[model samples]
Target: MEDQTTQPSPGSSSAAYPRWVLLEMNYKKNDEDEDSSCSTPADVKTLAAARTTSGYPIQVSLRLAEPPAASCVCLQLQVPDDVDVRYPTVVAAHGDSVLIQVTVTNDLGGFWNATTDHFVYNAGAAAAEPPREPSLSMLPPYYITDDYSGPQAHQLHTRATGLIRRGEDELVVAELSLKPARKDSLELKTAELLLFRSGEWILKRPRMSYGDREFGELPLWLHTDTVVPIGDRVLCWVNLVMGLLFCDVFEESPILQYVQLPMDPCYGKPSNRNVCVTDGGGALKFVNIFPRCCCGFVGATGCQRSHGVYVVNTWTLRMSDMEWVKDGMVDATELWALDAYKGLPRIPLSHPVVSIDEPYVICFLMIEDNKACYRDQTVWMLMVDTRSKTIQSVSLDQGERRWYPDTLIPSNVSYYLNSYPTSRSDGTSKSNGQSQIDIERSLVQVRDDDASNSMLQSSCKLSAEPAVQASEILAALQEIPSYGLDRDDMLKAAYRILSHGNGHRFRSLLSLPRNLRKDWLLMEIKASED
Candidate 1:
């Protein structure tokens, strides 16, 4: 990458620069430097061509001849101001091993010097895939439980099921249901979540709600609008039950953690279950949107109950840094906020998601007025953008297919790695074991109605083959013996969650009935164990 020049802070000495060796982007020496013709990439040359005497950035890379050291190795990257240095710009991998990854995009074509945390650390490298001859684990039980409590043998429901595949990071998210710790309590709202990658299982933040009011049995569920995967981080547009999405930004550093975004109108609180979309830019551009809350502009006016041009708005998140100002000597941070699209009259928008095309977002507008403004019950495509502050209404072509957050577009082929099992285990399989997406089965709750099928009709088709031998998982007081409920009747409350889920390998199963227990949501996940 090209070098960027900046004025040093007043009275700050050059010693303020980091002591670790600074890595440059345009080093021409490497394994193939002896023969440059074979090793060059067209993208690299296109970047180099943009350089000028005045100055511009060029890409840089440092590939270890062997694996990285156990200790962390910090990297200093040079990018342009407009390059969009958010996460992995590119990633190089051999088999399952990640050799090098570029996480920034330069817009100005010159190197803008940017600082990042520890760049290379071999933390999970040892957890690489096992030999072809696999051996199961003995400790955390890489296998499913032997419990035989199910409507059809030993199956379980899971909603904490999703996958993130950008460059080198393939994080598979799954939830683990637990038996409660005390009486009067159902299950832990903060249930455990395991992220599977390479050949190992990594535990991530559990299913939690913001837990502001009280640490109730409900989880701090940031309802997933959609997962926006950048180079090394995956940003989730989650909600707070109001259908407004907020961003959960995960940063990969020496310490893997979620960095809080700018203060939202919600007073820096997290929520769940809202519609969301992404800009598909290099940095994570998460826009959690919902039907406009027309309750007098940020007031609690039960706006959904009122009828009008039902508009939409979004709260967003992006990469930011906490600065120690030379003037104040204290940390100050620039933040993000809700930027509403202008140029359009107030209109009602249904569950909206991002369009595959850039500078456009797709959502359906409803004729929400009791007056004769627009056709009632008819859906129109609403295209909106914040930077442009513009909105447009368009009619779909006759016989044209519609899209939704869960809409299934036809693909040449799909190998549903995380679908139902052929045998009697749960819906998941470990990497070292059978190739099933290592999900387990337990009895959970299911709603008894076909009213929700209309949403599925618009979503995408099946991603994996449907199981010929499908089963349902239910929760029984019988499973928990010591929650002070020795009697089988009072132990685990009797509950049933049928696998009537729909969309994207039943990914939308998360919308199961709300009557289901807060601690144990009704999820129809695939069972991997037999």
Candidate 2:
């Protein structure tokens, strides 16, 4: 419909090198297969079916335009709304260029929505990001062999060293082919990742890993010995390789400031894995949630016998010293652990979600059937405030929500505010006590009156209020009469008002009854999720 090229904004340096232009509205695989029918202005069309997930082929194609001279051109494959897509891959022709590859990368596995789809191909442009020095370890492979085409390929060896760039992160991978190096005794490799700072190799992680060459296990794991550069400092995740899985992170400074994830009563064994190390905003977030299940002992007397879990732990990497740039969790970071309280049967937590607008984690609760040891399965919204360490459970009866059989999760307001401006958790640190009072006063429900508007103008900040006073705001929101509407309808009204900056809340959630379909009377934000 309209052009949506990955162009810099008007205020940006208009001198963007190797500009992209739209020449045609579609991509045609052959003379007969001509279909120009994608919505975005990039005008992407079906190239080839690389792989299929949920019966949807991962198709790969290019925009009908010249490649950027400064970088490799990567584009997002805009799947049509009518497609039953799942985890898919890109396809290439029999003799096509060997560059096409499939990527299914989401911290919570792969699921892209209509608004926040991440299908942009990274054409390996160092200038695209703020920092200049690129992840310089991606290289092509060189074959060291004779008659490598036939089944005698085992006689040949291959070696390579190069950089691989995912969306915002990069990795320097190195590989080598050896001459009968005895596939039994492991080949040990040791090296160090050095960051070339103002001309010095600031030492990072020392590379050390044993390659199980017999089974083709890599000698060095990718993240075990790695250095990722955040803002001014580098976040280093180093496996000490000292018989234990304990890793040390040297943050900001290599000599002084550092934190070690130690072993304890539960995670003392190296076997307890570090599931992920996320750049939470910039807080250097790490997860160690390992959940396992086992069959019960013969004739054992336990409540958790029928369940598939015992305990779960989720730790947030909080910054103790705040002198440096302290960034933490962003929106939608998932924390998955089947941690049903011990001896109380399994909780089987589902739809786990880290908050976007708040510093809390919320999930829907599940209960064991016909169990008497613990019967508070009526708890609906299990919320854990990471900052306050407060675990508050909102029972189904608390909201009188038990009568509504159609209700799934206690509909929350955060989902609708994903696109709306939210106060950052860090914004609270910037405000004084008076500013806090100003925030609370401005949050009273916007009444439809000049006197109320004048009162709000005197108390409210000229700009947006920080998220420091979210609890007060939620209280204020609750005081407003729901009038038979749920949180979903309230959020829809809030979205409409914020988007258009007009209309009353209740009326905003409603439209003139559709002539054909009265079901459209109320707006549905997440139809599928509901």
Candidate 3:
């Protein structure tokens, strides 16, 4: 009988295999013959190099690290004859471990070519591998307070939801309660106020104290009745100082507090004295007082004064002396003032005057010309400098005062005067005048619309939805009963949930009572158990 075997050529693109063994072999004398018989080794080798019907060459090889100690042998069969023959043969051992290998070759370097040693393993094997987990870090929280009101005891708060950054501050929001002092005792006493935040209340002691006296009394007292917020700090000045006593409550402890008094140069002096309070530069002085109406002191300046036309003076009480005046003596000379207005007025007392510095005072007057002439129907603005003791007036070409008080002097002393002419309907003005007003109004409307649209778009872009959602998820985790999670764990989980998804939307969803109530109850149970 003839024996048949196959082998791959050197440098062939074929996989290495273990020892080859042949149990039965056959070979055909003719290449086209169907009946084949086993052939010799040389014939087998030739067959291995030749291609078979399956487009592969019949080949067989052996790869051996070590032979078996016992009689059992491990072997593999290579099928170079069939190109697509992935599994050519199967080998098994009865009692010992056996290695079975299959060889595949490619002319285009598609198989285990020497140039590319890359190998592909089984998907099942890869799936059985383990996975990795995630890690995180944490932060702390803080508080902040702003603009407070006493009368309408309220303030704004910007509270933090989770761990605050190291330097971040939280805002406190709260309402306040205010009570007026006794009318008789008000003169010699200061009002005491309180602040509240996060269920904790603090007392704010604001006493009017003179330099030597422990506490001096105020002549009048007033408080705010609205909620005060840090953002609305400007409203604090609205707490009118009728006589001397003025107080306000704030939601958050202020980082800084400032009090402004009208530029009253003759505040502590006798009503009849000709007090000459200078603007440092020989520009202005407050002389004489009206005594009865409390409007006597008029600003005056010598023509020789080189300072600007309108300069107001301001004085502040020293921290060492908390009184408006020290030892019946005012720090009359140590004052800071700034130029606030321009031009000189003909009628000084009839116009408004104000100071830009401490004791910052302002005066306002409305002028109406009823004469038949066109200029007579106009109104003018008169601003006075309490410090420089000078007057400045601007024509407000409008026919009548349509604005309340018709004029306003902003607390910000640096404000410039604004004026516009009103078109007369009595056929005295030209048709083009009405067109100008219409054009101005149209421009204003366009600007307002553009601004509104921009604001809305910006708000949508920076919406707090994502953060809120994360907070909700965290809150939900915190509420889990029987979780046995520590505060750190809860925070971690919350942060994780918040870090993903639309945080603000998540927060809103979590805030829903239907969703949050259950979590709250569960959290309560968990808390009780802990």
Candidate 4:
């Protein structure tokens, strides 16, 4: 296994520092579309801007689990100007490199899409350091959909892709696809691997080797849930319902090795509700949350609804012997009894993630009961320490501003933020490995002054207000729906209309007949369209 980036020293000045951070998968959207005439920097304004892609800008934010959510640091990715539809995913993260999978489509008519991977090295280096260009020389764009009848119809193929960084400059991109292996059975498809490295792409069909396992117990088919880079050139494709398929891509005669997972307690039930395979230290940690009924019996028949209680179980895999060791389990009742648990509701949690830094500590999200109406309600993140049997911390998840399905990825990127390459007078650049003492001292000073943390605030809040005249009542009415406070009269009018039952204002917008305000809003919409 490669040596991952080290966390801050315990003697550092910045008390209560973080190790691994929770990365927001979806890109952060800037307010450049609100007014195009602003004087923001060309690089900042053009990043993920609609002018380049006709879609929302792309940026990712990092937040400490223990701190308030407002202390997030947003990062803008370097996007090329030729793409139309931009979809980015953090495929792999190790040391100081973050591999981003950019699924782009230059087709304005939305007929096709392709993949371009970006490697961000030394991601959180100092702003004063020179910019390092990422390696993005990839194959030509191809269609993701097979139904496309365009000129590039021959390039239509869909497959699951993953990335792994071998050393400093060497990287590997792997694509997995299944082809039918006869017998008129869809479950008998053969696995094939397409590898890209050293400026060349190779397509090979590897043999599937199952050791000490009965063929009857094998999974009917392989459905990859997620791909994990299990160091030493080994990449794992995990299926929550089935097992894991590990393959060493660099081997001359690589083989897809199979390892069956432990007996799932939630099997025959809703097993997919809360399950995750996370990296713990250098081993693989599997987390599964079992919904326990109030009257026992694993939330089965003769019990109440499976809503509130749950049990979180964790297991660590010792790679040497390919064995899973049961770590520990924590019940929801033990957490609710703690004082810190009072801050969070006693609701069933979703998206249970095991902390990579502290394997005993688990992070979960408490969303609304109604899955469809979850966007309208508040989302909370809970950090529970199973070893100590205490709730570590809870923070409000800014759900409305962020896109959904943004899986929480725990990475050591936070440890590299303070480590950057220092240049000498002769133009020689080298990393100061032990300069974290100075970095922690500077961070302590920044945290002392609240005003110095403006970068942590929301991008929309930092945007300058557009020029609005008080006499422009139409503009005021138009901005009311946005809930902007640029015009005081318009804000008060809208509030009066919304809060009509307060009985404070006699002549409110609602009291002036509902049709009158509706007609004015319709006219504003029509005029804006014109």
Candidate 5:
């Protein structure tokens, strides 16, 4: 073989010399001829294996044969999983190597086994080197929980009161909590009272001093009572209570007037009186006042009429000498012969039930029929143009059913009957033989655009563009049974046909008004259709 070892200068322009030699040998061989000679191939192989025995505990040392032109050279070592390597000492050829230890985990429960194929040094040569494998260990455990016991556990209650005069104005009172629901950590910190009116909630006042502390009492119930409008004064009563000590708030103001009513009775105690702080209008006139009595008796005696007291406003007008009609109905009294306004007019019936909406007063007549106790008893609402003193009776078909006017949508009212007692004839009565009325009520708005009113007016008019007969319409309507037909429904259908250019035909039958006669026909038609 040619001489493979040579030494060359650092910067010499010559071919590179071999720095190290690579040897390859097999670990096992099979054959008797391989071991025949004293220095057989098998013996040579055995010696080679002994020299490269990686299983034996061996110490590896590295040294620099010559200083490199550059000061630094990166050193990397990789070992198999089955092998254990430790670095006792390390020195920087130029600087230092960062020492780091890491441990990895394997869930398979098997020994980590790894092998190495080759490695590269300086990107110039490659050799068989150990592969890098991570150290393994066991994973740890973790846990979590939630607990609360601070100032977030309190409850609240509310109370409200109000008073109103028939035509003048109204007074409202409301109270709220100063703190949040939780009382332990958070206490009642001041509170603000807000007035919800005319589509907006405006901050009225802020109450700071409530029985002491800057934030007020811990178990305190803040209250707000005020007279609203501040003008057009009226007579009214209010009593409300909200159960809460601390309350959460978004905003507050002190511009609103706050009156602290005595807490002896808490609610509206006529005895625990408040003054009208507002101005204008007439002097405070005491109208018809009815006391609200609780269901319990007073002073440990039998049930009395004046236990828990409240007052409701009846009417407020500058009139004297009001006559009280002893009618069984709640609202049926008349005022007559007033000096300023005389013969003004008395309510048609003995008692008149009236609901006041600003300038308009809705009057209804209560009819009591002892003969038809369970069947025909009804309440009739008589539409009255109070200003003109004109009256029109509105008969309810199912008057025996309980009915009430809707407050929100005034035009729409609801009617319902108790179904528990059951109808005796229908076996709807319970075992006790008490029959409950079955009734339901829905909302309805008056159709002002309805053609019935116009046609009826035209029929009565003498110089109408096209004269329609009132008698003819009446005759046609009278033929139909009026038992189940709703008055508005019949009138509505009649108006529908009349509007479709039937005025001449309606007038030809001058005996009855087209509106009336058509209503009658429509009633019959509806009954037959049902």
Candidate 6:
């Protein structure tokens, strides 16, 4: 492991740097990594190598012994010793555990090859045995639920399930199913839990309890994009487009607690621009990257279109009030004005992931604008600190596969890397257990019967002051001398937005044309810095 005392770059937080890593789930496998010539030893004990004796074909691990600079690490998914290298897809991640899946085949040509040392045919036994036809039964794909205790191999023959480890040998596999309550009606649907525990799988169909909502029914199209085990006995079935459906697997009768995400009017649809992550300190944060402008540029007509710049917003789940408290917001205009952004390419950014160790820090993937597809494009990961309004670090990522934002996740698994049992003290585990219990209890009180209310108000929450009129806003915009936009076109677009009775305080300077917006925006950026 690298020296723990290595200090971070000059402008970053004074706190311990590299507290967490930007984990790339796509494991890089070379030809040498696949040794089909070797067979699994019968008594292999360490997790350092691949194993098939446990019935699973692959194993997952987080390799952080000597981390690359800029707080980045690659998640290692060990391929079966006798099989070809296959990619492991990360389904969900919370804390130190990650849910992943990898396909496997029954073809064992490597085991039957005569060159292998273990390939020995008994002449006497072969003569008595009848010719056996090649079997067509392929082994089921492996779904791995890795825990902090270490990766354990389990053969789960199903999909859409997340595992939570309770102890060395105890684990729970929870799957969420949402379907119509009856075959006759498609509108009335029910959510059910399928749990695997104590060596048996049981389906729990609890009574449906609706939470506070204007619409008193489940989303007709609530597509579960991912499943996350949030801690304690609670797991969240998330729909990035809509909201999160949380359930406590330990309950005698588990109930779903629904929490709606703050809606962004610009997109109005779901995309990979948003992500949900947990702080190692036991807090759930939802980070969103608005591909449009959100600062003082609300009146700009073309801001909603893809201009390659964006605004990043973060909200923390106040488990107390069941409300999402807005944590922070940073606009690209402000970032571009800083010296840190000058050296970096002006590529488009996607995949907003918040750090597990430092909630204020966010990581993004930048891709060139000319690349039609991400297949072979060069990608860079940038870590930005919202509180300090500075770039923490930037690193080039070179992997041999297609890249996407979902392929990267924020995890604290590195914290456990070389510090497995022998290096860690007993007190560390006790403190972690206590912290987990505290976070788990935060979800215990979230009941479904609570009065349904609007979880997120409009982006611009109007105040009690008298409403501002369109004419007044237009008058202010007309005063900007360097405006390149035509007077009629600008007035029409500004009026179209402010015609609504809601009092939206429009900034005339921010509504300038692209060429003019930068000049005025930089002035305001410098003013704030002063």
Q: How much is 292 displaced in model 3, in angstroms? A: 12
RMSD of each: 26.7, 20.6, 43.9, 22.5, 39.9, 15.7
- Estimate, for each residue in 210-327, the C-alpha lDDT of model 3 and write its tens digit: 2234443344434431111111111121122231222223324332133333344432222112111111111111222211111112233344331212212222222232222110
| Candidate 1, residue 36: lDDT | 25
Number of the candidate with higher TM-score, 4 or 5: 4
Candidate 6 C-alpha error for residue 291, in Å: 2.8
Tens digit of lDDT per residue, candidate 2, span 244-282? 121122233222122444331233222232222222223
lDDT of 4 at 354: 63
Q: Which pairs of residues clash in candidate 6, taking residues 3 or more apart in a chain or in different chains?
A: 212-452, 213-452
All candidates: TM-score = 0.32, 0.30, 0.24, 0.60, 0.20, 0.59
Backbone clashes in candidate 1 total 73
Worst 10 residues of 1 by lDDT: 327-336
RMSD after Cα superposition, model 6: 15.7
Candidate 1 residue-wise lDDT, 377-446, digit = tens: 3333444442222344343322111111122110100111112212111222321221111111132223
Question: Candidate 1 at residue 165, lDDT?
Answer: 39
Q: What's the best-to-worst order under TM-score?
A: 4, 6, 1, 2, 3, 5
- Cα misplacement distance, residue 473 of candidate 6 (Å): 19
Residue 128 in candidate 3, Cα distance off native in Å: 56
Among these predictions, the greatest lDDT belongs to 4
Off by over 4 Å in 1: 1-143, 149-159, 166-183, 186-188, 199-230, 235-237, 242-307, 321-347, 355-377, 389-530
Quantify all predictions' global Cα lDDT against the true fold.
Answer: 0.25, 0.26, 0.25, 0.48, 0.24, 0.46
Ranking by lDDT: 4, 6, 2, 1, 3, 5
For candidate 3, the per-residue lDDT at 462 reads 26
What is the lDDT for 285 in model 5?
A: 16
lDDT score, residue 223, model 2? 30
Q: In model 2, which runs have C-alpha deviations exceeding 4 angstroms?
A: 1-184, 187-260, 265-282, 290-384, 387-422, 425-530
Candidate 4 lDDT at 174 equals 77
Residue-wise lDDT of candidate 5 within 212-283, one digit each (tens)? 334333333344322221122221212223211212222233321122332222322222222221012111
List ranges where model 4 is wrong by over 4 Å.
Answer: 1-18, 26-83, 103-159, 212-219, 267-281, 300-307, 369-374, 420-530
